[model samples]
Target: MSYPTIPAYQTQANGAEKLSREHPVLDFLIDHQEAFDTGKMKTEPYTVFHVDDFVFTKSDGTVLPPGEASWKGLLEGYAPFNKHYHEGRYACIYERNGIWEMVGFANVYANLLVPGEKTKKDQSGRQWDVLVPGAFLFTCVKDPTGPKGFKVKSMTLFGDGVPVVGEMMKRGMVKAEDLVK
Candidate 1:
């Protein structure tokens, strides 16, 4: 078996698996379309949502942007390309009940972080991988060099990050007043 890599296709594969972000997520969403569901699906990549102050980050200790970066060169050591979990550099933000909260992550893969994982470090004294995560999601297109342009038209949600934040706020760990503005 062989997969055809179009030198010039409708969409370029910078990272995300399918042709577009909507295809997979939409497929998954179709099943639960009745639910007040606004999130990506399992097919998409994912990362973790740590219980940070007001921001969520990947396990590497660096802030994972929300979406994918157009140029691989744009991805820095702080935000690695292949190492990055979501697409573009933008996390998915949803305003629920007048709250501009981050409902999911898009730029990097969301599922990387799971519960009970421990922080691992490398010889450079920097974190290599994060073990624990609150949620996961997927971004679209990491690289594109054709007419379509490499990018994720839609982002998908996986695991569960919203509840993580909600729990934090409810537990008095995170301040809702700071975000509910």
Candidate 2:
């Protein structure tokens, strides 16, 4: 789908303009601007996708199915030390006040060693494990949220596990504070 023509100032080196953190999906939703402004647009809820479900193709165009190890390897490659569990969810993308907004959710689990503790050992010096749960809002510029978008516009962590309305009081990884609205 074609996105709204980005302003000249927003263009980057690669020419694709950067998405605004304050209104992440505004440009993408330009096609439905009228419906959004009039509150006539409908939102799709409970859309789900997984990172591991991607299918890869060879240079000659042979399709490869998704594999467990490939998915784990992707997470390992990106996070290295941390073991990651990602559950991609779509909260909704709706128009309000002449702007598009992405209200997506995700449950991410990262197995990390406790700070200042060595080898996952507890106070008793025995083996201990810790899984850091993080709740994140996954926003993008794609019309249909899927694996097609190679570049991620924004990822803001709100809290641990699934998020609730007005629960921004708790701190996690705060990327864009304005996005909580």
Candidate 3:
């Protein structure tokens, strides 16, 4: 899977550098930095509302209602983080066949945090405070560089049972139609 590496804004010693306005998704995150910092961002879970005729298939090929599917077994017994579950929107911009393409995703994350232990080193040896995703909803081009662009991929609704893709769309967290364009 070829995921596009979006560039991060470089910061100088004096202060944070100005971010490029070319990326809307990145711009959105920057604009809401305060909301993120203050821990006020809220995104509804996918299961709270009903969808007409929606079915999801697990990795093992079992089909079930979108609301009933579970990724609990994969989380190592860590519960979902409801208060800070939604991690906002992101975009991966890349080129294929000399054509510019963008893939967007709404990240709904589930984590487990120990009261006393606040951080752990990830596989890359970097310490992170947030629990690794017990479950997540990834939208638009799963793994990227495939024919599955502009669709919901693998996801787990552990925290609020909200489907990140659909719920984000409803709340304007992401523009579903713009993802594939």
Candidate 4:
């Protein structure tokens, strides 16, 4: 598929909730999500790219098939640490918006979007690595309504995912916040 479908996410994934107790960074972030006075979300990050600038060739000068690492889908390689990765959900990281905090997310798994079977060398030059393009995922978009102080927004992306969305996706993954530590 030229573009990946958006992923479905909840405030707490199946595994992320457990990890929140382990560290403060994860705890406060997950428990207390920052919202506007009416509980409107301030953050709306939605793009990701790899560290490398879409390089199809390896340092050794080898070509690779597409899907080497796609930003479009959850890379299967991350399967082993699904729980640990989900913990990233608690990471209430945000992008800068005129010095104000934006939205909070469970995790933003940004990486290289390499085609399948591509080989790339790390800075250490010790081994080959597959690249996954960066991607932005939000827990949910809050739309508060009524006196009860409630809201309902789409938790999952609707329809097919577009590789680039407006200007955000075109910007690529440049911000430190967009990447996973």
Name the best candidate (by lDDT). Answer: 3
Query: 59-161, model 1: which lDDT tens digit per residue?
Result: 3344544434311112222131123232232224332342223233232221122232224442224342331222333223322331123223232233344
* Residue 121 Cα positional deviation in candidate 3, in Å, after optimal superposition: 9.4
lDDT tens readout by residue for model 2, 1-181: 9986533212111122222333344333232222322333322211222232433323233334554443333233224233333333334555444433354433333334222222343222343223233333333334245333322233334443223111222332223565575
Tens-place lDDT per residue, model 4, 116-172, is: 222433333322223223222222222123112212111121221232221223444
- Backbone clashes, each candidate: 32, 0, 4, 23
lDDT by candidate, in order shown: 0.30, 0.33, 0.35, 0.27
TM-score of model number 3 = 0.28
The order of the candidates by lDDT, greatest first, is 3, 2, 1, 4
Instruction: Report the Cα lDDT for candidate 1.
Output: 0.30
lDDT winner between 1 and 3, please give it.
3
Better of 1 and 4 by lDDT: 1
Alpha-carbon TM-score of each model against the true structure: 0.20, 0.27, 0.28, 0.18
Q: Which stretches of model 2 miss by more than 4 angstroms?
A: 1-80, 88-90, 95-100, 113-128, 142-150, 160-181
Q: What's the lDDT for residue 135 in model 1?
A: 31
Q: How far is candidate 4 from the true structure (C-alpha RMSD, Å)?
A: 18.9
Measured on C-alpha atoms, candidate 2 has an lDDT of 0.33
In model 3, where is the ten-residue run with the lowest total lDDT? Answer: 9-18
Ten-residue stretch with the least lDDT total in model 4? 45-54
Off by over 4 Å in 1: 1-148, 166-171, 175-181
